[model samples]
Target: MKTIAIYGDSISTGTHGEGGYEAMLKSSLSLERVYNFAVGSSGLTRKTPVGMLEVLDKNPVPKDAELFLIWHGSNDWYWGSGMEEFSHGVKEAVDRLRAAAPTAELVWVTPIYRFECPDGMAQAGEAYELPNKNGYTMLDYYEELEHSSKRLGFPLIDMRRLCGIHRDNANLYLEDRVHPNRAGYQRIGAVLDREIQRFCIY
Candidate 1:
């Protein structure tokens, strides 16, 4: 059995008893082990002194990992990190992962679509107070990551487009317009599993 390593945020860590998308993928793919190196409230860009990239460096993936899946950016957008900064963080993270897993295949999983939450947005905006706040959005982050993936020659899975989570299905899928519920996670896992099977040749 092959081992898969996941580097992500709270979405990879289970929410409300749901094992999140990574757990779902583990079960669906029937892999030997799935190492989830994700933390809640972590983003690619540093909102705090220690960010996801720093966390990853401290806790490296196993040497035997055959694949690496990188999923982040929700918190970056929420915290209002500029695209350029986000891109730089991503490049650094990818470089570190490549150095750690020289032979492993790397894939970038774009950030999922987050529904508009007026209260949540207002609170985050006030707390972060990022510059050029009006121009930042989840889609912008997604597009930038897509470009980065292409430039870096890494495969990408656009979860936002693939998952099809829209306003109508937000309640059923997402717990708080940002995190997905159990059913929503299952859907994401299904799509990821298919993508893995289709693209990853073990």
Candidate 2:
């Protein structure tokens, strides 16, 4: 059986008051082995809650795993990482994973756009703010990584575009404005399934 590994942040952990897509994808695509190595509030940057060494030491990639799904950058982007720093972190992670799993394909999932908090939850956004914070939108960061993926020759999954397409159709997320609800996770899993089938299949 083929195997897939996920390395990412809170969204990957499904910590924003919602279940993650990892479990769903594992169940739906039972043919592929799945390992989720995600931490809450993580970032691509070494400064964040998790870094390459931590992920590697904690969750050693299984030799049989055929694909590595990298879904980081939310915390890094919000906490403050310019294109140069962001690209470096991502490249470093890619290099590490490549070294560990020489034959595995890498799939990079771009960060999603941030939504305006509902009036009641606006203050909540402020409490979680990071240092050197900028007012630039999340789309800016997503685009930066998207460009990097193009240059790096990795398959990029644009969650920002997916969210935009589905934003009007349903309650895609929770009130936290960060975590996606069950429906949202399902949506993500569907997209991942298609991408994995198209590109990562052995």
Candidate 3:
């Protein structure tokens, strides 16, 4: 793709300077622009101060962007954002994206698994399946994305289920069972790159 725009939370707002996924895309493809309008602590619900709604309203998407990736939901689950709210927000966000950039193809990405790593990334955390504040698990969040995307007729990249990172191998990629280290970012980026190519959208 000549240009790309992104919308999501911390995972999507990765350490680009330190070899984040966006950096890999920019360097590998010699992209013209990679507009990552993601912020830390962002989510899909209206309650999120810097969520998708805020990003689209405040950060303008490049008109020439060939593709747009929406990687969120993890933080939504963590914030206990209403499941119904997330579902409706997904459609609203898609409509907003089309209105903003009619030619930019949209793609949805699910959230990766996370855990409470008390000792850090030296090993995989045991409590990877615990529910969040609103009593929703990470799986609940990503699955909701899949359901919403399917109903809305959009291509979705199931990063949570497809990415190789898991409870056993999380320590190798994740720095704190949540954010990915440089190596982790690279691994996830590779999967993402392959998926985008497979869809022939970028």
Instruction: Write one digit per residue (lDDT tens) for candidate 2, span 29-105.
Output: 67466777888877777666675446776676776778888887676655555657777777777777888888888
Q: What would the per-residue lDDT of candidate 3 be over residues 88-120, giving only the tens digit for each residue?
A: 899899988888788778888888867752221
TM per prediction: 0.87, 0.80, 0.88
Stretches of candidate 1 exceeding 4 Å from the true structure: 48-50, 116-134
lDDT per residue (tens digit) for residues 1-202 in model 1: 3798887778887754366776667777787888878778777877623467778768866888888888887777765676888889889888888888788888888877665432234433211122225457776777788889888878888787899887678789888877888888878888898887777767
Best by lDDT: 3
> Which candidate order results from sorting by TM-score in descending order?
3, 1, 2
Q: How many pairs collide in each candidate, listed in order? A: 0, 0, 0
TM-score of 3: 0.88
The candidate, 2 or 3, that scores higher on TM-score is: 3
What lDDT, from 0 to 1, does candidate 1 have? 0.74
* Alpha-carbon deviation at 193 in model 2, angstroms: 1.0
Off by over 4 Å in 3: 117-128
Candidate 2 lands at a TM-score of: 0.80
